[model samples]
Target: MRFCMMESKGKRGVAASRDGGPWHVLFESEPGFPGTVDEIVRSGEGAFEEAMSAIEAGTAINPDDLKFLPPLTEAGKILCVGLNYKAHVQEGGMPMPTYPTVFARFNTGLIGHNQPLVRPTSSEQLDYESELAVIIGKKARHVSPERALECVVGYSIFNDGSIRDVQMRTPQWTIGKNFDGTGGFGPYLVTADELPPGCKGLRMVGRLNGEVVQETNLSDMIFDVATLISLLSEAMTLEPGDVIVTGTPSGVGISFKPPKLLKPGDMFEIEIERIGTLCNLVVDEK
Candidate 1:
């Protein structure tokens, strides 16, 4: 199933569906019901079954005219990986690491579909990294590679927007990647069962102002979703709503001859197979 937390008719809106097109509402701020998409996810399969019932009997909403909120609730954690794609690592003039280069992005930095990515006044080096993001549905720790995928609930698109200058200030990339409102993460969460195992062989494309700037088959990743999940689980417990942002492939703005960073009035888009598009605009800081 796919889920989106939105605002409709001045109230909290929740929409979910197993297939495509029109989505049915599970909750529009109904009393004593799951009030948010994350809550519905946290409710596990029981809530999903109930939502399916509504899909068959409830009024549906078209994708248009719905305002999207970041799909995550207060309990989510965004764990990102860097340079996991072989081509991307080569473009950056770096040797392949034996392990995934991991990083973190605060949930506060994320914006939903159609939202603007605030370009901080300090730098015009904002760049886009198109990625596939996984949302974990169950608690998992010390999971093995063979079974890591069992913990995933759904998949979504992400633009790991970066401030290049700050990102290279030191070895640490945390500050550069955490600028408020730079990351784009939501609007649709397609459940795991809706996709092939680990989303392998899917095409991921990144667009800048309607032009394709980056494109790669997700199979190019050095470490696939299952491996990353297994490795990450070794240290921390993965819980419901926890997000894993699989790294982007080659053709990022910074990889160009002169570096094609984003500017005011520019738009960025990340689209993946099975999942939907995640689009955002960039605006100059006031």
Candidate 2:
């Protein structure tokens, strides 16, 4: 089942649907439905199953009637892994770290499908990093890689847009990666049941204005979903809706001979096999 959180009539609602079908609002924030996506996610896997059941019995709304919104809720954590791809590490001229290069992204930085990624006036080196994001389904802690996948509920695409100058300004990459509206996180949340275990062996690509800039397979990740979830859960509890952006593959703008910086009027897309494409427009920050 494909689960999504959409906005209709100015209120957020939880909807479920099959691929190529209209969405059914199982829970809306209006008067009679459940709360936000965060609330449903926090409610655990049972909520997801129940919502799908309801959608099956209810009527679905036209896709045009709803506006896409970032599927993440404020209560959820956004943990991103950087340099997990060998080509990316080599292209960025960095050593292959034995550990996952982890980073953080706030909800404020996330935007939905078809939205504009803001390029701040302070930097012209805005770059794009196409990554696969896993959404946690249950509580996890100190689990082994073998059983790590049990906690994942679904998968989604993420554009880890960055401001290179600011990202490299310090040893830590948080500041540059946190600019508002830079994180493109939505379009759809494909359930785990619909894809191969750990979403491995899938081809993931990033296109800038119709040109393929980055491309790789999910199997190429230095640390797969199971590994990252197990590792991160060792010290911190991984709860439902907590998204782990596995890592972006190589071919980022800065990795080019000169650079391929994104500017206003440009379009970018993150596409992965099985999962759908997530496209966004680039616009100047006002």
Candidate 3:
């Protein structure tokens, strides 16, 4: 099952589809329904069954008129992994990491599909990092690697847009990654069962204005999903609706000789196999 959160005519709703069929939208006005994607995800399987019923009973809307929202608006945690891919680490001239490089992105930076990534007025070093987003469905603490995937509910795509200059300003990456409207997330959340275990062997491709810029097999990650989950859970509880952005592959603009940084009107797209493409247009900050 795939779930999408959207708004049309100023009303928020949840749209669901089975096997990529027509979308059935249930508005917030619906009785006895958890209207937001985060609600259903937090409630677990029971809520999914309830949502399925609501979706079937509700009307299907023309997608052309709906404005997409990030799959979860209120995720308790938005943890991001950096340099998980060997090539990505090599591109930045960093040594192979013995542990995952982690960072946090505030929700204020998130934007949905077809949204604009505001290029901050402070710099022109905006770069794109295409990655997979793991959505946690169950509470987990100190989980083992073997059972780590059991806590995931679904997967989505993410563009870990970075402000290069700011990111390199300090050793910490938080300030550079949390710029408003720079994180591109969503389009849909496809459940875990629909994908291979740990989403291994999938291909991730990133494009800038129709030209391929980054490409890699997800299996190439030095620290795969289960390992990252287990590692992260050891420190903090992974709650439902929490998002873990797996790290990106190499070929980012910053790695180019002249650096193909983003500018207004440039389109950045991230596509992962079995998931969907997340596209965003760039715009200069006013």
> By TM-score, who's the top model here?
3
**Candidate 3: tens digits of C-alpha lDDT, residues 1-286:** 8898888878888888888778888888876556699989988766776787778778887654689888888999999999999998999999999999999998889999998988998988898999999999999999999999999999999998999999999999999998988999988899999999889999989999999999999999999999999999999999999999999999999999999999999999999998989999999999
Query: Residue-wise lDDT of candidate 2 within 141-225, one digit each (tens)?
Result: 9989999999998899999999999998999999999998899987888888899998989999899999999999999999989
* Candidate 1, 67-181: lDDT as tens digits: 7877775546789999999989999999998999999999788888888988899998899999999998888899999999999988888989999999999899999999988
Q: List candidate 1 stretches off by more than 4 Å.
A: 26-28, 31-33, 55-58
Clashes of 3: 0
TM-score, cand. 2 vs. native: 0.94
* Model 3 error, position 44 (Å): 2.1
Q: What is the lDDT of residue 242 in candidate 2?
A: 91
For each candidate in turn, the TM-score is: 0.94, 0.94, 0.97
- lDDT of each model, Cα atoms only? 0.85, 0.86, 0.91
Q: After superposition, how far is residue 277 of candidate 2 from its true place, in Å?
A: 0.9
TM-score of 3: 0.97
